[model samples]
Target chain A: MLFVFGHQNPDTDAIASALVYASYLTRTGTPALAYRIGEMNFETPFVLQAAGIEAPPRLPELAEGTAVALVDHNETGQSVSNLAQLNVTHVVDHHKLGDLQTNTPAMLRFEPVGSCGTILLRLYREANLSVEPLEAQLMLSAILSDTLHFRSPTTTEADREAVEFLASVAGIDDVASYAMQMFAAKSDLGDTPAEQILAMDYKEFTFGEGDDAQRWGLGVTETTNPGYVLGRQDELLAAMRRLKDKEGLAGVMLSVVDILEEHNETLVASEQEAAVVLGAFGVQTEASRASLGGMISRKKQLVPALEAYFEQQG
Target chain B: MLFVFGHQNPDTDAIASALVYASYLTRTGTPALAYRIGEMNFETPFVLQAAGIEAPPRLPELAEGTAVALVDHNETGQSVSNLAQLNVTHVVDHHKLGDLQTNTPAMLRFEPVGSCGTILLRLYREANLSVEPLEAQLMLSAILSDTLHFRSPTTTEADREAVEFLASVAGIDDVASYAMQMFAAKSDLGDTPAEQILAMDYKEFTFGEGDDAQRWGLGVTETTNPGYVLGRQDELLAAMRRLKDKEGLAGVMLSVVDILEEHNETLVASEQEAAVVLGAFGVQTEASRASLGGMISRKKQLVPALEAYFEQQG
Candidate 1:
């Protein structure tokens, strides 16, 4: 059986795209199962429940002989465990490529769109298959989540078109209102512990390996108001410190972005990371928190800026 | 105009594939020009002269606004100079990938075939376009040369089928006799100058840059009999030293392989490289030269063995 999956710490786009792609393959006479590398996050479960669709199974270790297709990610570190051992037949991704080498020539459909679900939407259209309402809703939720309700710089014209088309198919009259409801659900971390809050949207990036490796983490939390996170600074700081020590990372950056205001209030977990953030953002900082205006995208802005800083330092 | 070219040091496959692809694009109503990054080598001229096809234009400087498609090679250092400035529309290559990142998404058709011409052959069949007799001859010659008459380990079933089909189209009754004639023409390098002989089939492989970079040169000369090259060892050595000094390479290796016997006699220019070659091939050496039996294919055996050695050292 073909197991289709995405990157670890599965986001809405990764999980939804795998489900949609696996469904497409199944309908086209291929027996495939959709899987998630990690458990569903806070917002993803809400989206799946609203659409009346079951969550994909969490993937365990796969055998070397099993065939697989990748969605949303192409990096081996982010993909399923022991990715090189399995047969990778295809890659359908939207992110920048990493050091992914297949043993044989595989079909690669990599586009610079906002979400991998957008590519799946195009595939459905090309195959002349009518998408179910639940599938449409899942894809639409993926697009809204990844593009940050059209605020992300990663959003493209293709994403906009796909979002509109999927909205119509799902019978959603007001796209913006639905997106705000989903964002509010994601932002409602009132009773959740600080560690859970930090781990909700956490991601790690590593360059090199072993003693020469440089690794860092970024935890992004999107809220309607930034003060919600800044007010609980002490609790967040303790959790961030615990995570840094546990992971033995170079540093950690927690971004509390006001989605509506299109601004950011970043909390640096260590002095080393504070220096990097200062070099990257040139923003005002007092203690661990910094007030940075008009920087929303972690992919387009933060990661690239930090990578440039490290490359220069080297 | 769409400028189609290959890597520096244009081999038979590189030159012939560019010509074939340019012709296909032109026939399909695109204004394209075939260009070469380097001067023609010894065996390539014979292929073109026999087909009665003129050599492609030598590329000088390209404007930033120009459109280009790469074939055969994709590494930035080996590709056309100032590649980042031009708009790379497409890439069709058969080699392992390098650090190639385009500003925009480009059409990439990377196959693990024996030659770039083999990919072009599949493209022609997919488009249902009948190739001309001269073009068929050029492609057939390219496959034979790159796969070493199906002796190289990189040869696939697709290459074999393409060779037979192209042979039929080119009105060749005996494929083996034609391949031997081409090999004999390449092996007949007695009258050529030593410097020219070294430069004829030379290639450079590099990893990283600056002080951290490791750069090496490989000169492969195929002969029907081994004595033709072994007898002129002194002249070859002097020429190899001159090339090493001119190219600023870390080390240079000269491989004189007898095609009929499928054996390689490699000469190292330095002690450091001699140690590496000894470690890689496990062959005893007096001075810089060593005899390695059944190691003719540079792509499949020699380069991979040397790269493994360097990686282990790191």
Candidate 2:
């Protein structure tokens, strides 16, 4: 059986895309199973519960050369630890192409959309297959979660059409209301550890090439009520510091996103990270936080800016 | 206008794929012009003549950030000299993924098929567009050339089906005879210069990573009458030496593939390349030539072995 998974720090898109894509693959004669590489975030659990779907099991250790497929993300840093050893047979992502190398030719499908769910919907249509109700609901949830109800700058026409079609199939009458409910569930972070909160939607990236390459950890927590997250700023910063040191990362940042207002306030782990934020976004960091107004999409906004900054430095 | 071109040292598939895909994009609401990054091989000209299509113009000097689409290849080393500065909007290839990075998400469609033409056919079907006769002929010729009329090890079931479908669409009743005609045209290499012959179907690749990376130039010549090519072995070796030195390449090799006989005899530029051939393929080089029986496809048989060897050394 082929194992399909998404990036570590599983978000709603990562989890839902894997599950839907694995189902599609199995229906198309490729026996596959969806797997999660990391712990599910609050938003993902809420989405799954609402869809009435059981959560996918965590990925089990596999022998080298096991066949696998990746969804949502493709970068080695963000994937499974032994990704290089596994035989990656397919990748379906909606992000910028990363340094993903395969030994042989593989099926890679990428499109510039707001979420992987949008691409999966396209796949279902191309294959002449009808999306099941649960699959439709999961895809709808993923699109709403990733694009923040069409508020994110990364939102595209395809994403909007996909959400509309999926909502109809899922019997969701008011997408806006359902999106708010999902956001409310995501914001209900009651007593969760700072480390867990920081890892909810985290990703690791490498910039530059060869000797000049720098590995950085970027985390995001999207919520309708951002006050609760920012209130634990000290604990989050401490968690970021511990992660940076533990992972030997060049820098660490946590962007607390206010979904309703579409704003970002990033917490830096140290002065080095502060410098990176200042250089990348031209924003000053005070009290270990950088206010980035109207810049909330990490994939479209923050990561690209930081990549450009590091590339220029090199 | 968006520029669409294939890799340098354009082969039949590279040239045909760029032309057909550019036309497809234009018909689908995107104005695109096909171009060639380098000189076309002999077979490409013959194929274009058969399809009654004029050769695409050579790529002009493009300014930085010009939107471009890549066909048949994705590696920076085999692409335009200023590829890093160009905005790669799309890539349609059938090769293994390389270190290709884009600032934003791009439409990347890759599959482990025998030729890019097969994937283009799928695109046409998915778009619900009918393929014109000339387009079908071009794709047919490309598939036949790349897969060596279903004799090469790279040939897949999809490639065979595509050939049958394209031949019917192109109104070519005698498929085998037409393939022979194309091969005869490809093999009619008269008194071309040694350097020109070496560059007919050459590609540059970087293996390993970071500081340990080694750049290599691998060229292949597939002809039904391989005796003529084997007779000019010394000249080809001299050309490979000149190219290796001029380009500061780690090594250079020219594999003369006997299309009808299904065998490969590689000409090494120097002892270094000879050693590489021995280590990579377990074939001893005699008089600067390594006889690799039943190994005709460079992408399928040669490059992967060399990549593995270099990676092991690193």
Candidate 3:
């Protein structure tokens, strides 16, 4: 059976797109199983709970020679651990291509759309395949999450169109109300472990390979209050240090974002990385922490600045 | 009107896909013009000639606020020089994303197929649109060129399927025979200027930005006999020096590839870049040139090694 999965950290878009694409492949005569490489985050579980669907099976490992398909992400660094060993048959993603490549030519469906769910919805329409109500709700939740209820800069006319069509099919009249509910669901993290919270939305970038590889990981935690994470400063620092050591990373940073306040306070775990972050974002550092106002999108704002910083170092 | 074009050093796939996508957009109510950013390459012109069509108009400079759509490439460095100012509404390409970003959301249709022509063919079929015999021939030729008639490692099953469908529509029974004829057409470059011939299939990679920017250009000239290019070593070296000076490039290398022999001999223009080329490809140099056995693909073989070299340098 062909296994379909998304990136690590398992965002709502990642989960929903894997389900949708796996279903599409199976319906089109390919036997496939949807899986998740990591644990579901707070928002993704909310999507599943709202849709009353079972979570896709968590993939611990894949046997050698098993064919796999990737959705929502193409970065091998953020994908399965043994990604190079798997026979990647197809990749359906809406992100930029990373270092991922295949031994053979895989069917690649990469777009710069806001969400992979949007692409899957387009595929359903193109194939004249009708999605069930639950499927529509899953796709709608994914689009809403990735676009921040159409508030993000990444949202496009196609995403808005997909949301409208899926909303109608899923019998949702007030998308704003549903989005508020989802946002409210994401607000609770009082008792969660600091490491789990950090791991909820972590990404890594490796500049080199082999003996000269330099990797850095960035974790983002979005909530209604940044104070929640700030209160656990000691625990968060310990968690970041542990992750850096465990992953053999060059550095680590955690960006605690206040979604309602539209601000982010990043805490750098190392002095060298703190310099890089301060130079990149042009912010003042107070004890390895800096405030960035109105900077939300990681792919659009944060990644580019960080990339520029590293590139300029050369 | 939307002006659509591809990267510099226009190839058959770039030219044909721009034409096909522009036609699709126009038929679907959006008026569009297909353009090429650079002068036509040898093989691209042959494809247009065989299809009995005139080459697309060359784009010099687009006015500010002009809406543009990019095909075949998405790198701002490789695209129109004034790309940052244009309102990019769409991007349909099969290559890796470069540092191109739009201020507004674009309807991007990027795939990792062998050729952008393959994606355009799929678009035509999905829209229930009919392509003329000449259009089919143009797309067929593009697929053949990009995939090297199914010999390149980038060729996917989707490309093969598209090729079969397009060949039938174009009334060609023997694809091998047609490919041989096209290859024969490409074998003769008797009296072309060394600089012009080198610019025919050139690519650029810019690492940093602003004062710290590092830019390098790579050119590939595939021929049945590399002896012809080797005989003009002085002229080629002068051409490379002129290009490096005019473009303000950090370095430039021209790879003379023998298609039948499946080998490449890269000529370095400067001593600094010569060391880089020698170290990156791990080959012995004769003066300022090195022979790489069985290395034909710039994308698959040369680029990755160069990237590794640059990354390792940091």
Candidate 4:
């Protein structure tokens, strides 16, 4: 028996990717239990129920020989809240490569493309497993969310191609409207605090030279209205500022994207960091980077520039 | 044995969705052959190859007692193209409802949610099947293309939820850039003739008043760099008008859209049709109905408006 896991505060991509992976593995005669570290949100349950799929039991009873294959997020020794005593043997994630594990007989596949769901799709093919609809819908959802409804630069040729196929099988013709509604649903920040909204779908970035380590947790929060992007900038900035002051190295930016307008607002940690980076890209901005036609997702859209800036700084 | 089939001039959504369905069928115990009536273009190959999947065989030798499934587009009366003699036991698609045989013993599952792949995903789940990677990727791609990367208003809640789930399993944190690039790849129309470029993705829309049956084919041709959109509009319009005059469409509006800008120029045979239909949706016009955000897809985006206008005309 083996276990499939994802990170805490898991997003739609994480949850759905894990479930699909588990389903694929089992269909291929691979015994595995797909589980999450924390409770799945309302959006996840709705997605699974509608697709007629269910999330596997969370952290179910594991045998001594159980091997864990983590999905979406990796355990970088910074936290062990969920698996305090458990052991992970393999990992499948689609985030920036971290110093996850060097000694464990595990594999880490990280690419610049959008969702881990895509990676799982690759694995399914490599394993020669046939696809079923529950897993298909889950993987499709994961890609849509991670790519921000396919509006992110992190998306790849594979993504577009996959979407074309899925469009036929899913019986959906107006994918844009469906994507809008999903984002709108996730962006509705009712009762949730600014911090919760900010940290809801977050990732950490570590750039520049470091002796020990320097990491900046970056996240993008969406809103129902486009103007809400401006409304939450200050709160998000302050949070980034606190992290900047605390970490004291490199840049940490929060991007507020206007999905419909095809525009973005990148909130930088410091004017100097923005200055250093914008010069590399031939822009001058200290407040928020607002360009109408540029790509949105912070991961693929902004990371290359940030990396180039770090190289320049070096 | 089963076969997966789709409509003519199959768009990315129709083709990709069929691929996913075929993948699902093969992954399970049921083996299927994916077949199409028309041609496959440049961009589609990339998505299929990216996922290491193949489109269905066009004219595979079938055995007796073979079953076929209809997806995305369907036709009757004159013995369908890819499936003339086979037992079409199931019709799983997302299109304007057509004249399906009332007494045929077939499973009919159709929904209007932008992409047919979304419905196939549901069908797979209801049947307790699994969604493997390649199929998942295809379904996800279909959703993006059908939804215009999630910009149309016809997307349903079920479609939205399924896409969210699929993204995770596909395993990318960002998809927008991937979609944009795919669209951009298709957008490069480089000196091609107006008619050929337009046929890159042209579909027949059936509309009529009483006994008068009209079929209008709408398509778009794009170019890169300076004066690209307007420069090609005239030639494109002239070509479409030729079809309009020949086919006797009340109007054939080719909404030339700048993907990055989302602005489109609608070239129509009938100004009143553009006025009554496109105008009702707030599409701006310089010569014909134009809009900054007018959708480009004909499936869910245009059919609704056309149907509504036709209904109102009666």
Best by DockQ: 2
The C-alpha stretches of model 3 lying farther than 4 A from their native spots are A207-214, A245-248, A270-274, B1-15, B21-47, B50-52, B56-116, B125-137, B140-314
Minimum summed lDDT over a 10-residue window in model 1 chain A is located at A101-110
lDDT of 2 at B244: 95
Question: Which candidate wins on lDDT?
Answer: 2
Could you give the fnat of all candidates in order?
0.06, 0.94, 0.10, 0.00
- List chain B TM-scores, each candidate: 0.94, 0.97, 0.92, 0.81
TM-score of chain B of 3: 0.92
What tens-digit string does per-residue lDDT give for candidate 2 at B1-314? 88999999998999999999998999988899999999988898889988888999999999999999999998888899999899999999999898888878999999999999999998998899999998899889889999999998889999999999999999999999999998899889999998999999988888788999988999999898888998999899889998999999999999999888898988998999889888889999999999999988889889888988998899
**What would the C-alpha RMSD of candidate 3 be, to one decimal place?**
8.2
User: Of the candidates shown, which would achieve the greatest TM-score relative to the real structure?
Assistant: 2
lDDT of 1 by residue, B122-189 (tens): 77775678989988998898898888888887898989999999999999889898888878877777
Task: Indicate the residue-level lDDT of B189 in model 2.
Answer: 95
In candidate 1 the C-alpha lDDT for residue B116 amounts to 80
Give one digit per residue, the lDDT tens place, for model 4 in B47-94: 677667666566455664467777775445212542544666666665
| Candidate 1 lDDT over residue span A1-314, tens digit each | 78999888788998899898898889877788899988666778888888888899888788875789899887677887788678787678876656676544455566677888888887787567899988899899999999988898888998999999999999999999989888887777777888888887778887434566688989888887568777888899899999999999889889999988888888889788788778777775689988777778877777878766776666
User: If both were scored by DockQ, which would come out higher, candidate 1 or candidate 2?
Assistant: 2
As for candidate 1, its clashing pairs are: none
lDDT, candidate 3, B165-248, per-residue tens: 999999989998887677666757789898898799999976434565578989988776688888888899899999999999
Q: What residue pairs are clashing in model 2?
A: none
